[model samples]
Target: MTTRTDSDHDFLASARRTLDLEQQALAALAARLDASFEHACRLILACHGRVVVTGIGKSGHIARKLAATLASTGTPAFFVHAGEASHGDLGMVVESDLVLALSNSGETAEITALLPLFKRLGTRLIAMTGHSGSTLARHADAHLDVSVEREACPLDLAPTSSTTASLALGDALAIALLEARDFSPEEFALSHPGGTLGKRLLLKVADLMHTGAELPLVNHGTSLRDALIEMTRKGHGFTCIVDAEGRLSGIYTDGDLRRTIDHHGDVRRLTIDEVMTFGGLTIEADTLAAEAIRVMEQHRVTTLVVVDTEQRPQGILKMHDLLRSGIV
Candidate 1:
């Protein structure tokens, strides 16, 4: 156990106050949306090339995240350091690009220095800053005002509330542009093929469905012992039973074999139809693999048969298929 100190209490109070101030700043930013924001959205929506984001210091980091969000949401974008623009990296900006310049004060020396060139190159400029009347804002094609009432920092010298408002403004632009472009989840998935979301959206049931010879299949008249042998041989712990017309009749699993043995006291003489769970345990082949996982979860079953419109067994899927797809 440790003793409490007045200094620690004061520190906690100050931190709480700082958080309150920053939260209020963000709230103000959210409530202050105007036509300029819409104008910025339209500018980005009409762009033929990428949205080039640039800022200095803390704003630069936020710019990088903004660029990433934009790119992920169907708006092509990348970040360029304002500090590098003066050193011939300015060549990266093309007439087709839309530039988003960030400066909390709207007067960062490095960023302000780039305005003349952006104008000369005919790049569409959108400014995110605290002061709409600042030089940077005045030179921009559209100015997004992100002014805050106060800084959360005790010294008022550090960028706290100002940066929060700017970052929120950046996200507002990214998402607004995202909505305007009608970016779909499938489009977003194409850019994120390695992440969990990518696996969920980009990958479909067909990509991982057990087709070909790996499918555990048997005729409707298969004996329980034979179905058990097929289930064991396939290692999917299940088998699909079909009729002479190739229509799916039922599915047999390890659990069904156990239950059948309990009911008949012998697997050798029992037919698979007597042991298989009926219509309740099947899913469509065209259904999303994620949906298949949910069906398995809801029924507490591992095996599912993918059937066509005629209720014919097309393929077999197991909990392991969903697991391998990273969708479970």
Candidate 2:
């Protein structure tokens, strides 16, 4: 047995209140978007080199995420800790690079200390801060205000709403730059090769489909029993029927076997062309594996015939193939 206390109720209430405050903060941040945001996006897009993001503490975490979002969305970007910028890491910034600095107060000593070096290197700086009048904001080429009326913390000291606002603003900038650059899904997938999106975007039918001898192929005149043997041999639950010219003519699956048994007393006496489905669903070798999944799901089938431009049987794709390849 367990007992519930007043402290438990208070804890839940506090969490709900924190979420509400952060939601309001994001709403306010969205309403405060202005020309400075546009200028920041334009500056990053125009940069010939990378967008170097730097910050310290909680703001550093947000800056690292922003750099990752920017890099994956077609913009070249990386993160550098502001505290380390003074210790030779500042060499990473060049005149061709654009710097994005995050600071809630705009008075972070480590970040502000690099202002003179940034000026000397002539690297454009975009500042995200709560105080527009702070030194970092004043010296930056563009200042994005990420201010919040109050923190979600009960004491209003911890960075809660302010950090949320900064992170949302950073995402807005990354997405805006993505749209301006006309970034495509294929290009985004290239940057995230190890992710699920990369697998769906890059894996094609030809890459995973069983080809040549592995394909369950039979002549159109093959007996139903022979066709079943081929299906069992390939273990794809289906077999492809081809014409004399080696072109795909039809497909026969396990379901057809059940139906034939119900309709015909002896399916062994029937020819494959008489029982197999004619001109079944087929996909080209170059089609994305994701598209093949969609076709399989839409038709309620587990296998598909892969064909060439001439309609010749090239290969076969199965649900197991998609599952094994992680495209499902």
List where candidate 1 sits over 4 angstroms from the true fold.
1-11
Clashes of each: 0, 0
TM-score for candidate 1, please give it. Answer: 0.93
lDDT of each: 0.85, 0.93
- Residue range 1-328, candidate 2, lDDT tens digits: 7888876668878899999999999999999899999999889989999999999999999999999999999899999999998999998889999999999999999999999999999999999999999999999999999999999998999999999999999999999999998999899889877878999998899999899788999997888888889999888888888998999888888888899889997766898988998988899999999999999999998888899998999998888999999777
Residue 317 lDDT in candidate 1: 76
Candidate 1 lDDT, 1-328, residue by residue in tens:
7988876668878899999999999989888988999999999989998899999899898888988988899899999999998998888889999999889889999999998899889999999999989999999999999899999988888888998888888887878777887889888889999988887777766777788778888887787778878888887877888889988777776776667767787567878777787664667866767777778888887777777788877777777778876765
